[model samples]
Target: MSYKIIVDGIQHKFSSAHFIVGHDKCGRLHGHNFHVAVEFGGPLDPRYNFVVDFIDVKNAIKAEVDKLDHRILIPTASKDLVLKESKDNLDFTFSGKRYSVPRDDVCLLPLPAVTSELLAKHFHDVLSQRFKGFKIKVRIGETSSTFAEYGE
Candidate 1:
């Protein structure tokens, strides 16, 4: 019998960019209780007789998202600013406005913004690298009522 298991991860993000300017510098610094759910599909493992080990999946997925657990996630390749990384902090600047984030509590992703779709793809890509035994889908949510999923 084909078996499958779905695991979900939760995080919080303070983001405000969406390719279209609305509000000010990300709609006045908003936050979201982001929820990420990953669904794995495939036959049971030969050794464990399961599609995937839950702990293994958890570790892999967590490793990717734990970066954004409770922080301001931003793009590392933005032309309108620069990130000055120190030993324990990062200075994000835009038009002379500086946003300082603790190095231990911030994530600099290679994205233009922390949108739902990009967040999904980001997790999917990371997990795909660690878990190639089964297909997966990563879901990112702005709230309990809004979310997005990405995978093969």
Candidate 2:
């Protein structure tokens, strides 16, 4: 009566680290060949005898990450973040510092950092809002050896 789905993707690679305020530890700048994974669960369709179609799941994931990939991910909390969107390029700012990373190099994420764990939870939370009666899991791997997942 229940089913699951997973959506995954990978980043071209970038180097950066960030942490929320009230924290003393510094997250150094680093790059990760990130891999993303996602899972969804719901009632099985009587006709198909399966949960949501795999194609639907995959398509949804692709649509989401199309907004990311090959971009400098930044935080909204940074006072220096200056975002300028136009027909030509996307601009960002932080601490009076401006980074004119090519529009192609900026991935505007709904999440805070590029970490796999945060990405996992961010994916889970977004899909959960769209699902009517289902559970989902999202896993993002920073490397072949390091990955993070979120669900239930």
Candidate 3:
């Protein structure tokens, strides 16, 4: 039989800013204190009696969170958006609006939008690749009551 290990709480979170292109209101940049929950499913090891070590799972999730914390997430694949990078800054033009920031302050994702659904899928893909032999589910909280989940 297979077992599941889940992780969630205040520590499994990050704060970041993003905007959904083409959305009427969400197209405007905003920030969220986003939370993440990860579920790992597989047969438990007979010797360890656990699906996986909790500390290892937590560290893996935290590593992804650390990359997004306190940064502005940009969708690198958006056709409506243009990004120009210089030695120290990144310039963005979206829907006729322009924004510039230090290159170090942005996280460019290979996605078309920076919505919670896509973020969940992104994390799911990242974790699934890093940790094999288990089914992975990633839930991204856009707010305390709202979230998106992806699994594979």
Candidate 4:
């Protein structure tokens, strides 16, 4: 039988700023206290009697969140946005507007957009890479009422 483990806690959270390149309203740069929940599903290991250890899962999720904390997120694949990098800073131009930030404070993601849907998929991909042979689900958002989920 297949078993599943879910990890969602205060520790699986990150705060970051981002903007949609062509959005009408949300195009303006904004930040969110984003939370993540991960579900791992697979057949239980006969020796361990569990699909995976909860602490190990939590640590993996925390490590991913740590990379986005307190940073400005940019979609590296956004067609409407352009990114220029320097040794000390990163420059972004989106929808005819320009912004710049220190290289140390940015998280340039290989995503097409910075919306919650893509963010969920990005997290899913990250976790999938770290933990192989297990079905995974990643949900991310600013609040309980509004979120996006991705799974495989």
**Which one wins on lDDT?**
3
What stretches of model 2 exceed 4 Å from their correct place? 6-30, 78-98
| TM per candidate | 0.77, 0.68, 0.96, 0.95
Candidate 1 TM-score versus the reference: 0.77
Q: For residues 1-152, could you state the per-residue lDDT of candidate 3 as single tens digits?
A: 78899898568888999998778898898999999998999998889999999998899889999999999999998889999999999999988889999999999999988989999999999888888899999999989999899996
TM-score, predicted candidate 4 vs. hidden true structure: 0.95
What does the lDDT read for residue 91 in candidate 4?
91
lDDT of each: 0.72, 0.60, 0.91, 0.89
Q: Compared with the true structure, what per-residue lDDT tens digits does model 2 show for residues 1-152?
A: 46665555543232333333222332333355555676667778889977777787676666666555544565554443457877668666544445554566656665544456777786677777766677788777766787788887
Candidate 1 ranges beyond 4 A from true positions? 9-25, 86-88
- Which residue pairs in model 1 clash with each other? 16-26, 45-50
Question: Highest TM-score among the candidates is held by which one?
Answer: 3
lDDT of 1 at 78: 62
- The positional error of residue 119 in candidate 3, measured at the CA in angstroms, is 0.7
**Residue 8 C-alpha lDDT in model 3:** 86
Candidate 4 segments exceeding 4 Å error = none
Query: What TM-score should be assigned to candidate 2?
Result: 0.68
Candidate that beats the other on TM-score, 1 or 2, i.e. the better one:
1
lDDT of 4 by residue, 1-152 (tens): 78899887466889999888888888999999999988999999889999998888888888889999999999999888889999999999988898988999999899989888999999889888988999999889677678888996
